[model samples]
Target chain A: MIGRLNHVAIAVPDLAAATATYRDTLGAKVSAPQDEPDHGVTVVFVELPNTKIELLHPLGEGSPIAAFLERNPAGGIHHLCYEVADILAARDQLEAEGARVLGDGEPKIGAHGKPVLFLHPKDFLGSLIELEQV
Target chain B: MIGRLNHVAIAVPDLAAATATYRDTLGAKVSAPQDEPDHGVTVVFVELPNTKIELLHPLGEGSPIAAFLERNPAGGIHHLCYEVADILAARDQLEAEGARVLGDGEPKIGAHGKPVLFLHPKDFLGSLIELEQV
Candidate 1:
């Protein structure tokens, strides 16, 4: 079951501009950009009182977000991550309910270094959902 | 300054289906659908530990989300709402920094009955941002 609303990921064409808007324009505490080559993204964390907003930019060739960026040139909300207590259990339950889990139905280490699994957008009202074990 | 992330609004074509997915599939506490004729939306609130996820469906003629649903028939993340201490001051400062506030640059009563203003998506990397005075 989903616990906390982990973080909202926004894939942006320009990371600096997105970071500046959140940091300066919105006056939020934003972290320095960190390159996650494994995940194929450069992420900047905007810390909020209750949750986090992650600004993501494609990092290298064949980046996961590159295709998303192409479809959304101006960038958009990519996915919503929710904390789960048990990744494997959650996956099993979701699969049983006929909800498709992405990536071979296996949990992978996410950007936050937590075991995470992505659910198919088709089963989730076109909203990509990431379930992270916290 | 942005404080808490009040809620993330997801525009959906089918409110009942979306609510069922969040409540049963995702195992989150979801509220009953509340029709807001004034806002032209019927919303179901998924209450998370940190914040809320609002599932919106077009309510009446000229519904704001009608166009969005037409574009994304399966539904999608519509906007993000962040709480602010002083909305007028926040708007003034954002405008000063060249961030275009949506509408007539005046805060209106949002779904939660709080003063809120929407920022232009162009000035925010294609993400519609709502600032609500808390």
Candidate 2:
């Protein structure tokens, strides 16, 4: 089952613009941009008191965010993440219930340096759902 | 400033199916459906330890969720809601920073009985943002 809302990721065409909106415009604390090659994204974290907003930009031509941006023309809400105490248990439980986990059903290290898995958008009502172990 | 993440809303074409997915499949605690005639949405809240997931469906012919579902065909993440300590102060600050608040720049009572205002998706890197008074 899902735990806390970990982070909401927004895909943006320009990472710097997105970062500035949160940092300068909103006056929120933001982390320096970090390239996540594995995820094919360069992300900046906008920290809030209770949760963080992840600004994602495509890192390469094959980046998933690139594809999303192509279809959307503009960046949009990319994914919603939840924390789980035991990811394997959660994955198994979700798998047994007929939910499809993305990427060979194995956990990958996420931006937060935690084991994370993405569930197929179709299974999650057209919204990509990520589960991270915290 | 954005406070806690109040909820992440998903627009679902079929509210019953979406509710069953979270309740029966994920074993999440979900609330009964409530209709907001003014907003033209019928929503159900999935309670989590740290945040909530709002399952939204079209309540009338003019419901915005209807348009989103028409384009998406499948339900997807609609928007993210954050809590604010002072709605008016947050509004003024956001406005001063050039972020356009949607719906005449006034806070309306949301499902949680809180005054809430929506920010333009275009100014937010394509993600609709809702600020709610806590």
Candidate 3:
């Protein structure tokens, strides 16, 4: 069910600044920013050796990231993403184990153009987990 | 100057149960368990694509992980590990940027026998980050 770690998403107050911090200061190369209209957020990707770090900023006041930032003023980690061999099968297994998953019965296309589904934090010991099929 | 992500360590109360949960339910294969005598904790690894998930359990009453679990009984996501190409260079850069590092000026050999250092959560907007040189 679990494949590889897809990416680690961090909620940032400013995507550009965060991206710049990672690139200029940390020497990490930055990928072009992308706006996810569905999620009402803009994200910048910083590629690392085997994984990528996603810096997410809210595009609008109603954005989910905005609400998350509000609850966590320091803008901590948002979620952990794990690659899954089969999203539906993984979802079924998680559901059978009584884990609460976000979204309807379908997995949506995520920022990386992969099928992604989120599991509620309540189900995973307070960690918001995303399952991505790669 | 990061290498490849070594592993993402999650602080869990029950190492055996967590290991079982991941294996029996998620279909992730388990690796042999190892105890970090220096850290006063035991750990189990679950290897995935490109990375591994470490389940940490405190070994003694005064273990640091025990304190962490007390604060967050739900056992949420603990920290993110980034693989650095050069541990010293990366640590210097982070320190120059005013990030508070946990270890004293030197990276220690972690569970996987890689040089590792931890940055304070205060410096990373409430997210604890570990840098590992693989």
Candidate 4:
């Protein structure tokens, strides 16, 4: 079963500008930024009471974040994450149910070092779903 | 600060079918249904651990949900809600920051009897944000 909401990911064209807006304007404290070389994306997290807001920016030209920005010019919500008891188990369940997993076999370190796996939006009615193990 | 994620609202063409999918397919328990005459929407709530999923269907042809469904035929996510300490205070802050509130004046009882208000998508980039008070 899915637990609490882990975070909401937002795809942004400019990470610095988005971080500044979330921090200065929304009063959300920005966490240390991290880069995922495999995904070719950089992410920063803003912690809230029971969830966080993840800001994602493309690291290179051909990254998925870049494609997402191209598709959504206004820089909108990318995905919704829910905490799970076990990342691999959730991945297996989703895969068995014909959901496409973005990453390879294993779960990877997501924002705030949480073990995370993403299920493709096509399988979930246009809403990207992420499972994170806390 | 926001307490937790109150719910994620999805706009669907068929409320009964959506409720069935959430209950049988996803194993989520469906809450009692409610209708908002002012918004022209009939909604069903699916309760999770910390957050609920709201399936919104239009009551009339000219309703906002109808317009949203017309814009996205496949049935997409509509809004993300955050639980606030005080709905009115959050609404006031958002309004002072130039965010447009769709409803007039006071907070009304939303799904599950929570006082709620919606911030227009135009005010928050392209994502619709709802503030709910528990």
All predictions: root-mean-square deviation over Cα? 0.7, 1.8, 2.0, 3.1
Report the Cα lDDT for residue A122, model 3: 60
- Per-residue CA lDDT of model 3 for B1-134, tens digit only, reads 65566677788876777787778866788877788887777888888878888888888668767878998786767787878878898988888887788957788887668888988886665678788886
Model 3, residue B132: distance off in Å is 2.1
Angstrom error at residue A72, model 2: 2.2
DockQ per candidate, 2 decimals = 0.90, 0.72, 0.65, 0.46
**Candidate topping lDDT:** 1
CA deviation > 4 Å runs, candidate 4:
A95-115, B1-3, B103-109, B112-115
Selected candidate, larger TM-score, 1 vs 4: 1
> Residues A112-133, candidate 2, lDDT per residue (tens digit)?
7999999998988998989999
Q: Each model's C-alpha lDDT?
A: 0.94, 0.87, 0.80, 0.75
- Residue pairs in collision within model 4: none
User: Compared to the true structure, candidate 2 yields what TM-score?
Assistant: 0.93
Decreasing TM-score order of the candidates: 1, 2, 3, 4
The list of candidate 2 runs beyond 4 A from truth reads none
lDDT at position B101, candidate 2: 92
lDDT of 1 by residue, B14-132 (tens): 88899999999999999989999989999999999989999999998999999999999999999999999999999999999999998899899999999999999989888999999
Tens-digit lDDT string for candidate 1 (A11-130): 999999899999998899999999999999999999998999999999999998899999999999999999999999999999999999988887999888889999999999999999
**Model 4: DockQ score:** 0.46
Query: Candidate 3: how close is chain B to the reference, as a TM-score?
Result: 0.90
Evaluate model 3: give its TM-score. 0.91
